[model samples]
Target: MRSTFYTEDHEAYRASVAEFLRREVEPHHGEWEAAHGIPAEVWTSAAAAGLMGLAVPEEYGGGGEPDYRYRFVVAEEIARTNTTSFGVGLGLQDDIVIPYLLDLATDEQKQRWLPAMAAGELIGAIAMTEPGTGSDLQGIRTTAVRDGDDWVLSGAKTFISSGMHAGLVIVVARTDAEAGSRGFTLFVVEQSDAGFTRGRQLEKVGLDAQDTAELFFDGVRLTADRILGQEGMAMRYLMERLPRERLSIAAAAVAASEAAVRWTLEYVHSRTAFGQPIGDFQNTRFVLAELETECDIARAYVEKAALALNLGELTAVEASKAKWWTSELQVRATSRCLQLFGGFGYMLEYPIARAFRDARVQTIYGGTTEIMKEIIGREQAARYARR
Candidate 1:
């Protein structure tokens, strides 16, 4: 089905993104991957190309564009180029971290941080996952005790993306143990803070160019001015912003699946089996057909969700549905595509191999497949409550 989600400007933007990836990223991605982190210059280059700050207010040096398709185009072009580590890094900035600051930060906070972020001079990370807690935000054991005029923060956060080079991090900690969910508060911890420390650069199975690490805050003191929004309101803020994050994942998932199908199609048509093109086999045709059809259908749904998100009508439940389904489809589509490549698929040199490797993390991050389903189930039960 032909979708009407993007206008001519979006296509033009897509072209620019593709060109930028070819020039700035493609040649240097491998070195960054081996080095275990993307250089600071790449982020600045992205900002210069107007790719970093999609929705940031113009007065603060952002594009001030509120459209979600621009973000989708970036993800699609990155997937097509198979530079997913860069994609993940950019996604963390635009989808997850920027939104928090845009919506929740005070005017002074905006003045202090937004422009540098828009210019990519200041990299940001959100430290939410602790060693003990994976998806449970309420289970975070980090504490921020209130002093006379400052907050004394103490805790450790693991799996923090952009941890190595992040100049600023949004740390979630419990401020009032008795308040339960309401006790959790968000604080912006600057790198210059006395006790803030970044531990080892975590070596992952994939996304090597993206920095993921452990962060420690041992009695790091922060002023009340550092709080994002109100104190003890992080839970509500996180719940409100999570849908956008999930949709970002969904968009990437669809694009990744499409890229897998594109690679597989080109491969089967060129490679041979039994004295003929591999595509001549019935199984190969059926596999590609199914993958393409599913991707298109998924794209249609994602388009609707993206439109809704841009319009501010997207719900957590709807985004969850998109997240779980599209993520699982990405895994399935890439796996099937990989199998068609025979032994070549297993080789790291193949894009299909990297696609398959990247797809595994999709089902687990943003929110797990099981967690999404559980959210949908709980929402359904609420709607059909037994009185």
Candidate 2:
């Protein structure tokens, strides 16, 4: 599973991240899960440890090093600890939100938000998915009408990750009602905005520590400066960012699969059945072999995707292939690992159980497995047609 992609610096970074997760996150993750949100202190502590701002520029209290490998270290360590909630929340920030600001935000906008975001003071969330429009960007019903220098925003966003803690949110809204996909715009809604409200914290079957909530924009007025990039550019912005987002999911998926294999390996070796260790049995050995081989392959694929993303050469189709493959691999790995644990795996107290629970949503979010395949398939068909 060793790769030439990581240097000593990456390994050193991994050690630091592992230490932080062990000291700050491991003991308290259960508490956060029960509350359905990681605490503000955790965010601050993560920033202090240089975990939150890998993508942020150095001028803005960040590492300023824009390598995806550092982010991969964070994802892998979180997966090792089985902190999927923390993993997803951090992904929303580092993988998804920061890139928007990096690529699209103006200097003044960056000056206003990046420092706080780097320091974890201004928690950011993107309000995209509605109750009705899962990944259908064209179907978002949220509206923003230009009224003088302000845009009147009226809509509700459900399943918003980091919804409860977000001090700054990028709200996707329809700016031109008749423009279809071109109608959508991205607006930055601050926490203190009038009529902007966060609704009930959603209870999910997994990633319980990540706060997923309903957000309401009841005629919240936003200035022209609050607009990101340009009016009616949300869909394009989304398309541009899709590769990194999906790759982030892929990175986490591979890591989770590896973790599942690691956990099951130890369990099967130590726990005995019949006359010897369960791992000694042919069935367990075969399962372990398949799981390990699959994880190793996933690791290679994700690393390559990460490199491609760094080089700005990662295509949507490539990202989709990685995303769908690793997501399904994670589900399969967790399910198989949990099976090895027998009844103990079904109990919530076991980490394997949490892995099994958390793995279900991997193929569902970041665009479903079916959607990823469709994207890849469509591109392949178009290329073949041209040929």
Task: Give the candidate number with the greatest lDDT.
Answer: 1
Residue by residue across 57-82, what tens digits does model 1's lDDT show? 89999999989999999999989999
TM-score of 1: 0.99
- Candidate 2: where is the Cα deviation over 4 Å? none
Q: Report the C-alpha displacement of residue 243, candidate 2, in angstroms.
A: 1.0
CA deviation > 4 Å runs, candidate 1: none
lDDT values, one for every candidate:
0.94, 0.91
Clash statistics: count for each candidate: 0, 0
RMSD of each: 0.9, 1.1
Output the lDDT of residue 12, model 2: 96
Model 1 scores worst on lDDT over the 10 consecutive residues at 1-10
**Model 1 pairs in collision:** none
Residue-wise C-alpha lDDT for candidate 2, range 167-261, written one tens digit per residue: 99999999998887788898999999999999998888889989889999999988999999989889999988989999999999999999889
What's model 1's lDDT at 224? 93
